[model samples]
Target chain A: MKRIIEVKNLYFGYEKNLVLEDVNLDIFEKDFLLIIGPNGGGKTTLLKLILGILKPWKGEINFYDDNISKKIGYVPQFSSFNKNFPISVFNMVLMGTIDSKNFIKKYKKEEIEKTKEILDKLDLYYIKDENINSLSGGLLQRVLIARSLVADPKVLLLDEPTASIDITSQLNLRDFLLELNKKITIVVVTHDPTSFAQIYDHIACVNRRLFYHGRGELDAQLLEKVYGCPVELLGHGIPHTLLKEHI
Target chain B: MLEVLSYKFMQNALMAAFLASIVCGIIGPFIVTRRLVFISGGISHISFGGLGIAYWLGINPLYGATAFSLAAATWIGFSKQDKMSESDLIIGILWAFGMAIGIIFIHLTPGYAPNLMTFLFGNILTVPRFDIFIISILVLVITLSVLIFYKGFVSVALDEEYSKARKLPVRSLNIGLLILIALSIVTLIQVVGIILVIALLTIPVAVAKEFSIHFKKIILISILFGISICLLGLFISYYIEFPSGASIVIIGSILLGVVKGVKKILKMKLNLDETIN
Candidate 1:
């Protein structure tokens, strides 16, 4: 597989304290890489650095000879969206195709057609003209995903893709992602290991540092190491941990 | 109507209202949608410092106000630290300082304040021909800029981070918006005065937002609302001997209440249908 992103000795901080330290990783093209970690583990920070939303204090991130910030499609956490905002699904998706230099021109016919196709592919064609504020959480998530796809990026970086949605929507999103991984690189930051186990080619457990980066199933031993507890895998691929001993 | 048009000052006031409303209508949606109403208020109040400085230096207060407000706008736009609350604190301090300076200049001016109440409460009847010309040109510039940069502006207004990820110039666009707001503040001062300017800038846009979903339509409706309110206010002030600025604002508030009330009724009806079915 071809290497699409390479990060070497990346370091970043907000103030006196460091958030991410001496991080190094390589992402291959068309690879579904799942980054798992607890809250405040710097996973979102790492994604921000890759998207060029924040600059690394030291080291560099290179994307296939171009700046990673320019080409990569980023789906931020849904919490960033204001529920009362009055944007439409079509306009929201059209935002993905916008760049700094082309501020003057309106959306072209080809771009509009492409947005329609992507919305249709995501089963969101019916909600194209609906105000984003009116949609349910699941439908909004699908719209955001469609927006990310409209950019036609080589890599799709999702920050907590299924954080706050229904189970059906979560499964639907996972299935859609599984299919999407066949065409482009997918990097998802999520805590749910069960649903993502089969889809991801590699899992990187992050906790202030990268604990492990390897392939294969997420066995109990690895979960224990990452979560500092014994994990039990229930039916339907849900993870339940036994804390009687700790208590 | 013909007799009213015969007076140059009345004609000038009408022209100023038309020009000011055009700029206000175009920029008003951005102010409301981006939740920058407070920032615009901060800028309007801060322009007082420029007014003071101009009075003290024997220069045009308009120039002073523009310079001060634009400077404050630039500072607010460029200071992108994580804590936005801290930035707002800084804006508050600047706003107070500007007001203080304006008062001091007024005190130092040799004349009997040159009818300061007119500038404070807006005497549209006294608007000059030159002010009308300036307002017209400004409206033209503002409208053209909005037309050319509609997509960028919309993207940034909708979501700044997403726009930045697409490599759009989010910082520059923000600064541009602030400058536009400063200009709008200066243009509006003659019609509504600084104290009531935000009401004129925000109320029509707020009403239009409840009725329209598209940006272009909102702009059109806001312009219509602003012009109609101004004309009605002028007529009422002329016949009833009332304050023009207050009259305009009162009419605008009533219109806003009616629109919001109607929208609520329609939404409730739709919800009733959904529940019943």
Candidate 2:
């Protein structure tokens, strides 16, 4: 597979305090990359650096493709937005088509058509006219996904896509993402890796440090090395019993 | 009411109110959605420092307010950091500091500031033709800006991080929005005075949000609400001989209360009907 992005010796921090140090990773075409870590382990910061939202203090992030900004789609946490703000699903998704070049212009016909197509593909067309504030956490998650996909990105980065949704919605979103991964590279930054188990091609455990694994399953030894503890299980709320016994 | 229009002053006041409503309504939804009410309040108050300085200089106070407001808006917007507390602290300092500057300058000015009350608690009935012209220009600028940058404004207001990730001009949009907001605050000063300007910018949008679930709709409804409230307050102030700014705010607050109360009762009724069925 062709390499899509490369992070080399990355160092980042907020003010004087450091968060991510000497981080390096390679994202390839159509790779399902799952980044997991404990809370405040610089997982989201890494995603932001890749997306160019935050600048790296040291080192470099190289994108192989030109126009990487337009090529990469981002889905932030569902709770990131103001819940009371007035916005329709269609309008919200339509905003995805807007880039820096079209800052002062109105939406074009093609962009509007593309937004509709994305909503339909996500099974959200029927509720396109509905207010976003009226949506359930799960449905809102899907709408956010639809918004990101409307831009026709080559690589999609999701920050905690399944953070607060229900089990059924989580499973449905996993399947949808799996289907999408067939078409484009998918990178998900999640603290709970078990939520998307058996789906990721590679797992990168991060805790101020990053330990990358090629296989889908991470053994207890590797988990301890990353998390700095014996890992018997990894999931949100419920125990997954997925890890092997630590020797 | 028709007799009031016969007078030239009354006509200018009405025109001022109409134009003010248009601009305020146009920009109010953004202020509401972005939760910039505090920042706007800070900007409005800071303009008073300009007003005071302008008085000391024996120049047009509006010019001073306009200059001070724009500067404060830009400074506050650019200086804002990631932490909410830090930004809030900045706003708080600027808010009182501006007012203090205004007070000190006015005190230093040799004579009594005859039009001081007009700047503090607006007298809409006394609005001059010059102020009306300025307001009309502002209305035009604000309407055109909103129309042109509607998508960018909405995107940045909703999610700055996501907009930045999309390579959208987040900084430019934010500064642009702040500039428009500062202009709106300056225009509103003649109608509501610096002390009550935030109310005129917010109350209509607050009420309009109750009726619409779309940004464009909220803006349209806010304009309508603002115009109605301003006119009604004008009429009431004319008859009852009350402070126009205070009257306007009172009417707006009452309308907001009524809308919220009525919606609550209707919701309760629906719940009862559902339970009975």
Candidate 3:
């Protein structure tokens, strides 16, 4: 597979406290990469660096054949949006269509038509006219996903896709993501490994540093190194026990 | 109310009210949704420095206010690290400093203070035709800008982090918003002085928010509400001893209180119905 991104000796931190240190990773074309890490283990930070939101203090993140901004679509964890905010579901998702230069121009007919198509594909066309504040957690997640996909991005990045979701919806969502994995690249930062157990192309573990546990059976030592503690691999398949912490 | 409208000053005040209400209506939802009420307050108070410098330099007071507020707001938005609280601290100092400069200049002015209370507490009855004409043009400019950049404003207001993720020039948009806030303050200070300028900008939108789920509705309701409050406050102030600026804000507060009370009663009634069912 062709490599799409190259991260070499990356170092990043916030004012005086270092977070990501000497990290390196490669994301290949059409790879559904799962980046799993403990809480506050720099998974989000790594993603931000890759998205070019936060500048790396040292080292470079190189994206092949295109700019990161034009190539990637992003879905944030929880947007602290006011429920009383006056925006329709259609308009909220339409915000993803704007870029730096063409903000003055209205969204074209074809672009808006494409947005509707994506909404329909995600089974969210029924609530397109509804106020965004009225959506439930699952529906909102789907809307955000549709928004990220509307631009036809080469790579889609989601931060904590399974957060606050019910088990049934999580299973449904994984199935949907598996379907999407065939068409485009996806990099998900999540702790819930079981949800993506059968769908993922490769599993990468991250702490302050990264350990790429290449695309095969995930061994125990890699999990131990990533979490900085001992862990157990109990089973596999749907709802697989990727790592059960030894208590 | 008819007799009040007969006078030239009252007519001018009414026109000022019309202009200020429209500008307030358009700008209010953005500031409220973005939760920049405090920043608008900071910018308004800083406009006081402009008033002071205008008096000291023998220039138009509103021009001084416009210059100072625009500078202060742009400076605050542009000169920033990541910490929001620190910027708020700087805004606080600038707010106080502007007021201090205004007071010192007003004290230094040679003549008999030129009725400083009008600028402080807003004597809308004393509004001149020139100020009325200028604010009208400003309202027109504001309306055009708002309509043209409606989507950009919506994106920035609703979800700033997500807008940032989309690479939407979040920094420029933020600074642009500050500039708009500054302009709105300059227009509003004549109708409601430094002490209550933010109230004029925000209170109508606050009530409107509960009723409207769309920005067009919010903006329309806020404008109507602002105009009604302005007219009612003018009439009430004519009869009562309360200052017009303070009275406008007081009326807005009472209306907000009433809205909250009604909402509470409706919620309780809904619960009662659910319980009965």
Sort by DockQ, best first: what order? 2, 1, 3
For model 3, residues A1-247, the per-residue Cα lDDT tens digits are 8898899999999888899999989988889999988888999999888887788999998888566557688887765455557777787777778766667678899879988889889998889888887788888888888888888888889899889678887888888887887877889998767677556777667778877755555554554443422123323333334543222
Segments of candidate 2 deviating more than 4 angstroms = A216-247
How far residue A144's Cα lies from its native spot in candidate 3, in Å, is 1.4
- TM-score of candidate 1 to 2 decimals: 0.92
C-alpha lDDT of residue B200 in model 2? 91
Best by DockQ: 2
Clash pairs (backbone) in predicted model 2: none
DockQ of structure 3: 0.51
Ordered from best to worst TM-score, the candidate numbers read: 2, 1, 3
Q: Would you list the clashing residue pairs of candidate 3?
A: none
All models: lDDT? 0.80, 0.86, 0.81
Candidate 1 per-residue C-alpha lDDT over A179-238 given as tens digits, one digit per residue, 9 for 90 to 100: 988888999987765567656777666666664455544454645554533224211133
Q: Give the DockQ-based CAPRI class for model 3.
A: medium
- Which is the leading candidate under lDDT? 2
Task: After the best TM-score superposition of candidate 1, give how far the Cα of residue B149 lies from its true spot, in angstroms.
Answer: 1.9
